[model samples]
Target: MSDSRSGLFGFVLNGLGHMFRGGLLYWAWLALLLVLIVLGGWHYYLQLRDGLLVTNMSNQVSWGFYISNFTFLVGVAAAAVMLVVPAYIFNRKDIKDVVLMGDTMAIGAVAMAILFVVVDLGRPDRFWHLIPFIGRFNFPESMLAWDVIVLNGYLLLNFGISFYIVYNHYQGKEPNASRYFPWVLLAIFWAISIHTVTAFLYSANSARPYWHNALLAPRFIASAFASGPALMAIGLQIIRRVSDYPIRQSVIDHLALVAAIALQVTLFFVLAELFTDFYNEGEHAASARYLFFGLDGHTALTPWIWTAVLLLAVALLILMIHPLRTHPVYMNIAFVLTVVGVWIEKGMGLVIPAFVPTPIGEIYEYAPSATEIMVSLGIWAIGLLLFTLLAKAALPVQCSFLREKAHREVTHDDA
Candidate 1:
């Protein structure tokens, strides 16, 4: 047992050493990550000194790109549950191959989501007040407090499950059965809770007609599944090109299927919203008009929204066609485009429309201030850096550990 433990320690250290000595692409990515971190840190300092006034966010447009990114990332985080359910619960082999990748992506996305909220807060320093036991939770009433609980809980669930799986592989053992099965169940429920709570956060604001509908939760889930699978597909392609890890083409095909279904659901919900707005012709219709057309003398965001719709159509077309979806190059291009298009739609498109005819009947537009943009970029850089290092250390074990253990078992049996 001690020998086995020592071997595992050596394996981890060796993986780290290899990453430091890895190819130019690895070094280049790390360097770019460092630059982003420095710039982001500097911007955060400026924001601290200048305050929220530095941001284009006014009383009308209180939530801007920051909140948009937060909303989008929560979906990304929830998408991992899709993979988790299939792999661990239903035992789907096609998704099992890429489950670790999905798990890693979830970790990265959740970390970024939390960072966005921290940066957006009026008093970032007071964020520590949410710490469990030490902080006031005001439960059963405050939806925001519930959001904090669900988000943090979901993060822990993902991290714990991922860590156990990786560590077990490192030790040449399959994960403990008791631990694995329970977390799988936890992950499934936690997945729904995270996105549902996020939607509830918006819907709870009855004054915000655009977000008040009962359909918000379903819409959020639909958007999340679409964008999340698209991102996973893109990440898989990157891993395939960069490393020796084997990702079966069959797995890519399965993810493509998921992306297609998600896109369809997203389109359905969006159309439903349009129908409700046009059919009703109330304040809600007026809000929808600003999003689809233009109102209050504001037309800057209309073109971008149309562009997002066109890109979504393109993505759907690519996925719906068999040849396009299966062709690696074309599929990859479509996946990247879809991810970017959704980010724009969910981040900028969703945010701007909510504030169109402000509560006080004035128009307010929001663009991320230089400091806000820089701080956001920095958080992204940090997430990338953490993920890169984690992949550097963890990927090797995942790729070879199981095979190594099998070989050892065969040797022992022969002996």
Candidate 2:
């Protein structure tokens, strides 16, 4: 037992060593992320010193870029379910090879999501108030409390599962499925719950009629499915090119198919929502009007919403067509489009619109100030940096495990 523990410790140290060693481009990438982090950290310091006045948020439109990003990232984190479901439940060998990347992504994304929430708080010091026993933690009633639970719970689940699998791989042993399979099942359901709870956080706001719809949760899930797989597909291709990890074309193709179908469902939801809002335009339709078109000459988000629509439309066209979806170049193009389009639609288009024509019948146009932009970029850079390091460390161990498995299989065949 002592020797085994020592071996595991050594394996971890070796993985850490590999994380720090890389080529010039890899170092440059890390350097760029560091620079962005510094710039963002500097701007965040300014915001902390001066308060939210440094941001464009106000009484009329309180949730701005920070919450927008938090909302989108929750979906990205939840999207890991796409990979997990196939790899474990259906037992797809191709997907199993790269599912660790999905877990890594969820870790980075949830970290960012939590960071965004922390930064958005006017008093970051008072965050302990959300703690269960130590803080107020009005659970079962407050949706924010629920959000706190699901997000943290989901994060812990992924971290525990990933650590188990990665540690086993590093020790040159296959993880026993029975030991971890139940957790995988829970993580899958927990993934869906995280996003659903997030949506409920917004929809529970009875004052915001725009977000107070039953459809919001389903819309969140659909859009999440689209964006999450699109991102994983892109990451899988990059890993295939950069490492000897044996990420199969079948995995990429599977992810693309999921993204395409989810994109269709997402577009349908959007259309249905538009019709519901416009078919009998009235007081409730005010927010929709302010978003897509101009309301009382306040056209700030009009162009932005239309631009998002155009991007999603174009991406949908590209992804839905079979030939284009199968073509590597066109498929990648569609993936990029889907990510950006969903980012804009779910981020700016969703969060900002609901607050446009405030409850008091006053319109306030809001945009992220330079400080908000810089801080947001910094948070994003932090997530990317975390993912880069985690992937760098885990990929080598994964590759080694695959080689060992192949050898064992050949040996068994010969015997």
Please provide, for model 1 over 78-108, each residue's C-alpha lDDT reduced to its tens digit, 9 standing for 90 to 100: 9987788788888886677669888888888
Candidate 1, residue 150: Cα displacement in angstroms equals 1.4
Taken over the whole model, the C-alpha lDDT of each candidate is 0.82, 0.91
Candidate 1 lDDT: 0.82
Off by over 4 Å in 1: 1-19, 405-415
Name the lDDT value of residue 148 in candidate 2: 90
Best by TM-score: 2
User: For every model shown, what is its TM-score relative to the native structure?
Assistant: 0.94, 0.98
Q: Which candidate is the best by lDDT?
A: 2
